[model samples]
Structure formats: structure tokens, C-alpha cells
Target: MADWNAGQYLKFEDERTRPSVDLLRRVPLSDPQSCADIGCGPGNSTELLVERFQNARVIGLDSSPAMLSKARERLPGLTFVEADIATWQPEERFDLIFANAVLQWVPDHPGLLARLVSFLKQGGCLAVQMPDNLDEPSHRLMEKVAHEGPWASRLTSASAAREKIGSFEDCYAWLQQAGCAIDLWQTTYVHPLEGAGAIIEWFKSTGLKPYLDLLAPEERVEYLRHYMEEIAKAYPAQADGKVLLRFPRRFFVAQRM
Candidate 1:
């Protein structure tokens, strides 16, 4: 099982919810009878699903026990389960499956997408949002630095492990082939935060997970410091004491035939 820090995951609940809310707004949920939130970290979006589908039985499924514990503590009445999205099977399927910022981690994008869509009832909706920033400088820099740096020898063994990342067109084509009417688009969220170090902190919670796990304790700190310095140079702060961060994300809403 992939280990994760509950405290660190839950800390970004509020920050994650901002984009989640925007994605949910585009969903055409008239009255879902049953809903599932895959990769429901800390139940941030799970709580929103509850309010949106009051009569529906909502289930929040995640692989992390720590995160599931936090979810249960925050919302006792709602259901939260420890399950991997790649292998999880619903007892009776769902009317709606809401997956926000989760698909990027799965190994088989096509297979995973097919499996999730198969669980949807006829006419049921599958709404998903994933980070499309793999092509951006933020992520590319990590790859560039890792492969060329002094620590490259240590990471060489794991270098072939590919992260499942796809383009908006790639997602749209896949969903269309699966026989779902798809609505796809890209949105760049410019989140303005206070001062320089805040962007580094934000990434530490979200984007730095994989890279951090690969480094030694001391090397991890040095890597982060070096990364922050590089990022700060490009995204200098304004006179008002804030930094504007452009985070590009892709959304796909597909309804079963």
C-alpha cells in the first residue's frame, strides 16, 4: 500500500475544495439515487456530495486508512471505505460516480476509465477532474532535475515507472469510444496566495508527494529548497504581497448510454 500522511492530506482539504466546487457546478445532477466519490481524501468533496444529493446514499472510497479516518471523523453519518480504485468493486454499482483529481495516479488510464464507466448504471453520469499540468514547467522541472542531478543514480532504478498522464483530447477520445456523451474542457485556476514560500508549501502538499518519497530525508529537504528557489525566480511576488499561481486542470463529464 502507498503510504500517506493524514495530517498533510487533510491540511489541503479547503484548498482542494475550491476547484472541486467549480467542477461540481458543471455536473447535471438532478437527483442521484446513489453516488460514489473515488479518492475522497479527508471527505472535503464527500461532504459536498452529501448536501447535493441529500436523498442519495453516498460512499467515499480511498486507499489511505489515515485519510479515511479523518473523513469518518469529520462526517460520521456518511460512509467512507478503504479501497483502491484500480480494484474496488461496488456491491450494486451507482447512479453517479464523482472522481476529482484522482485518475492521474492509476497505472492504466484506459482500463481504469473503462472499469469506472462499466459501473455506471444506464444514463448515469461519471464526472471526473484531473490535473493537466504534467506538460507544464512545474512538473517538467522535477523530471529534468531528477534525471540529471547527483541523486540520479539512486532514482535510476525507478526511472521507468511512468505516471499515467493524459491530455484533454486523449481523455475525450477514450470516453467517446466507451459510448458516453462527453463534455471536456480545460481551465486554468489562478490562485493568488500570500508571499513567495506559499507556492512551495502548496506543492509540498500536492505535487511533491512522489518526488519526496524517492529522496533520502536530507536530500528531500535540499531538493525542495532548490525547487522553491527556481520557482520563486519565475513567479516573483507583486507589490500587494501575493503570488499568482496558474494551475491548469482538465474536466471530463461522461454519461452512459
Candidate 2:
């Protein structure tokens, strides 16, 4: 996949950063000395960490140069590193390893969670929030549309870009075996938007990238038109003529002992 488009992702900055705010509110740490924001796209979530832990040394890590550049520009005082979550090796540990909307893109949740836990100091917390809306209409429609187009053959496995993250129960079991106390929950946010076009722009930054990457410019235009038509059918406009995009997310805070 091409480097993440930081500008595209930040279009819905407020909405995209809302979950990070909620997740950070539950991090049961009084004074974490060191912190790392994994997949800290454009520093929105990383800025939250700095504000909440003013005294801590906060660093943002991401694989995308565009994102890291934006993040660095957003907060030049803090450290930003280019690193892949799946293969990152740090020279030192941290009191908080925050992964907001990042882990889903990395495979092997059990192993990945354990590895994150390993990076924390004793009593340190590993806080994570991941979109759990694969079964939702928006995503289901992505798969549906992917298969119905001439680009279907090339995009056959695009849906697999985000592998099944497994159930929250499975996540609990994994953390338990990793010797951590866990707090986990699920939430569905009904985000109101102008129309299906707004909805398309939202996912175009994240979930829709894999499919769009495989198509020609004209083919992408056609694919998006079909997607928009399906989205209109799936998400009815509300009383004020706006559509509601239901986004489900899973959050967990695991404290290492």
C-alpha cells in the first residue's frame, strides 16, 4: 500500500480523535515517565498524551512518512519516529504504550498484544482502541462492492487487509495469560454526516484505501459511485437530511504487573 495520506486522514480530525480521548481518560496511570503513541497519525492522539501527561517524555511512532511529517509539524517539541508496529524494537521501555486505531492493521492480535505488554515497565499500561465494525453495513458493502466490479479479480483479497481481530473474550484471555489486569469495552458511535458523499470521504482515508489502490483512476470513480449508491441504501438520511454512520470500536487497558 502507498504511504498513508495524512491530509486525507485528518479531514475528520475531530471525529477520528474522539475515541483517543475516551481511551486516554481510562488509562489508570497517575504519572507515567515515558510514553509511546503507536500509529500516532498526525499527532492528534499523541498530543492528547502530552496534555494528560505533561511531565512524561512522549514520542509518536508511525510507519508513514507523510503522517510522521504532519505529526512532527504539529508538535515539534516531541519526538516522532518512523517505525512499523509489527517489527519495532525499542532501546528502552515505557510506562504507557498507547496504540489507538493501529493494531487492527497489524496481524496476530494475541502475539501483538503480548509484545506490546512486554514493552511496558512493571505496572505500566498498554492502552488500545480498534475499530470493530467489520460486520457493519459500511464494511460489508466494501466487500460486496469489491466482488461486484471488474476490479473484483484484482481486489479479491483487499478485504483481508484488516484481518479478523478475534473476539474481546479472546483478547481478555490473551491479556490474562500475559499477566496483566484488563479493562475492556465496546462502543458504537453514530456519527451524523451530510450524506453518503461524506461517508465515502470518511472511509476513503482508511477502510477504502485497499480497494481504491488497485483500481485505475476511472475505475476508482466507478467503484466509488457504486459504493455511494449502496451506502445511500444502507444508511438512510435522518430527520435533518443527514446520514448516520455507525462506527463500532473496541477498547482495552491492560496494566502489567
Candidate 3:
């Protein structure tokens, strides 16, 4: 997969940040001494973590320097680290680890979860939220568009491969196997926004990254145009000139044993 376009993907941070915060709130972190926000794009969620745990020393980690730059700019008081979560090794255990809307992009969910669990202090909390919208129309349409359109042949390889997203049952079981007491659930948020094209704009910031990167400059426009056309038909605007986008996400909150 092509590297993420942090600038584009960061646009949806405001919309996603709330849900992520709500998920994190479920974890009973009264006063964590140390915290880490994994894949904390642009520091939006990282700032939330800082506010939630006022006394904690919070660190935000991301692979993109551009993202870290923005994060640092937004949160000068907090520290931001440029590191790939797949290989990052924390020197000491953390009282809480917050990973929101990140793990879905990593290939090995189980292994990554295991590593993050290991980084937690005994009784430390792990709160994670991932977009469970892969099977939803918004994502499915991207696959359909890429696999059947003019760019079918070249873009087929860029399509997201079918992988386990770790359902509530799977997540609970994995946490149990890792010796954690877990609380797992799912939430579908219908984010209502003005304009019929907002849905397309949302994906431009995220799901469209890899596909757009793989295409020629000219083909990119064509792909986006095609994508928008399809999205309009799939998600019709309401009478008030707004669209209701149902974004379903999954959550896993576990306390390390």
C-alpha cells in the first residue's frame, strides 16, 4: 500500500476525534502517570488524551513527519515522536495506551495488539477504536470502482485485501488469551453533514489515499469523479440538503493482567 497522505487524511480528524474520545472514556483511567497515543494523526486525539489525564506525560507517535509537524504545532506542550508502530519499542511501560482509527491499516492485528499489550504496566488500560466500515457501502464502493473501472487492471493490486477486522468476539477472545480483562462493543455513528458530496470529501481524506497515489495525475481526477458520482447515488441527500453518513466502528478496552 502507498504511504498515507497525512494532510489529506488529517482532515477527518475532527469528525473522528469525538468517537475516539468516547471510546477512550470507557476505560477507567483515573490518573495515569504515562500515556501513549499510537498513530495519533495531527495530534487531535493526543490533545484529548492530555486533557483527559491532566497529570500524565503524554506522547504522540506517528510514522509521518508531516503529521508529527502538524501535531507539534497544535500541541506544543505535548511531545510527538516519529516512529513506525510496527517496530516501535517503548523503553518503559505506560499507564494507558490509546490507539484510535489506526490498527486497521496494520497487517498483523494480533501481533500488533500483543506488542501494545506488552508495553502496558500491570493493570494498565488499553483503549482502541478501529473503523469497522470495510463491509459498509462507503468502502465497498471503492473496491467495486477500482476493480471494474477503466483502471481495473492496475488498481486491482491496490485494493484493500480481505482481512479479519477483529470482531467484538475476536477482540474479547484475543484479550483473554493475552491475559487481559476486556470490554468490547461496536458503535455506528450517523454523522450528518451539509452537502451531498461531503461523503466523497471524507474519503478523499482517507480511503482514497492508496488508490489516488497509484494513479496518474489525470487518472486521479477521473477516479475521484467516478467515485463521487457513485457515492451520490448511494448516499442521497436529505430534504434539508445534508447527508447522513453512518460510520460503524468497533472498540476494544482491555486492562493488562
Candidate 4:
């Protein structure tokens, strides 16, 4: 995958950061001396960590250099490291290892999460949040469009197979096996968006990026046009001409024993 565009991702910063803020609030840690923000993109969520854990030595870790660069520029006082959360290991354990809107990109939740738990010191916690909206219309439309058109082959092979995150029950068991006391829950946020194909714009920065990136310039425009036609039917406008996007996310906090 190409490096994420920090500027593009920040366009809808408020909507994207809400889940992070909500997830951070559920963390039961009162005074974590050391914290790591795994897959921390652009540090928006990391800022929340800093506010709550003022005394903690907070470090932001991300695979994208572009994202890490923005995180560093935004908070030069804080430490930010560029590394793949999947393979990257820290020399020392952390009191809190937090990941928001990130694990969905990585495969093998069972192994990956167990590795994360190992990074936490006994009594430390691993907090994570991931979008569980793959089956939602906004995402389904993308998959449907990807498999229908002439662009199907390229797009499907390039990026259409969304990461397979295990079910809620499976996740709880995964954390349980890691020897942690876990808290797991989910929430759905209905966002009212305006303008034509506002839903497409919402995904353009994240999910749509891969498909768009894989296409030719002209193909990109065509794909969006076709996608817009399909999604508009799935998300009709309200009386006020606004579209409501229902996004569901799952959150978990595991305290290592």
C-alpha cells in the first residue's frame, strides 16, 4: 500500500477522530507512565492520549512516513517513530498501547493482537478501535462496483478484498487467550452529510483510496462516477437533502495479567 495522504485524511478530521475520542474515554488507566500509539496516523488520536496522560512518555508509531511526518510536525515535543506495527517491536514494555482505526488494515488478528499484548507490561492495558463497517452500504457499494466493471480485474486484485477481521466473539477469545482482562463493546454513529455523493467523498480518503490509486487517471473518474450512481440509491437523501451515514465501530481494552 502507498503512503497515506495526511492532508486528504484530515479533511473530515472531526468525524474520523470522534471514535478515537470515544475509545480513549473508556480506557481505565489512571496514570500510565509509558504509552504507545500503534498505527497512529497524523497524531490526532495521540493528542487525546497526551491530554489524558499528561505525565506519560507517549510515543506515536506508524507505518506511513507521511503520517509520522505530520504527527512529528504537529507535536514536536512528543516522540513519533516510523515503523510497521505488525512487525515492529519496542525494547521496553508500555503501560498503555493504544491503536485507533488501525488494526483493520492488518491481517491475522489472532497473531497480531497476541503480539501487541506481549508488548504490554503485566498490569498494562492494550486499547484498540477498528471500523466494523465493511458490510455497510458505503463499503459494499465499493465492492459491488469493483466486481462489475471492466476495471474489476485490476481493482479487485489490487485492493477489493477488504481485510477479514474476526467476529466480536472471536476477538474476545483472542484477548482472553493472551492472559488479559478484556472489555469489548461497539457503537454506531449516524452522520448527516450534505452535498451530492457526500458518502463517496467520505470514503475517498480511506477505503476508496486504494481503488482510486490502482486505476488510471481517467479510470479513476469513471469509477467514481459509476460508484456514485450505485451508492446514491443505497443512501437516499432525507427531507432536508442530507444523507445519513451509519458507521459502526468495535472497541476493546485488554489489561495484561
The number of the candidate with the highest lDDT is 2
Task: Estimate, for each residue in 179-199, the C-alpha lDDT of model 1 and write its tens digit.
Answer: 899888878988787755777
**How close is every model to the real structure, measured as TM-score?**
0.92, 0.99, 0.94, 0.97
Model 2, position 257, has a per-residue lDDT of: 92
- On TM-score, the stronger of 1 and 3 is 3
lDDT of 4 by residue, 108-131 (tens): 889999999999988999999998
> Tens digits of per-residue lDDT for model 3 on 1-257?
55556677666667878777788779887999999999998888888888888999999999878778889999998889989888999899999999988877777877778888999999998899888887777888888889877888888756564244976777777788888999888889998876656787787757777687788999988887888888888888888878889899888899998
Q: Give the TM-score of candidate 4.
A: 0.97
Q: Residue pairs in steric clash, candidate 4?
A: none
Write out the backbone clash pairs for model 3: none
Write down the TM-score for model 3.
0.94
Q: Which scores better on TM-score, 1 or 2?
A: 2
Q: Candidate 2 — which pairs collide?
A: none
Give me candidate 2's TM-score against the actual structure: 0.99
Backbone clashes under 3 angstroms, per model: 0, 0, 0, 0
CA lDDT of each prediction against the hidden true structure: 0.79, 0.94, 0.83, 0.88
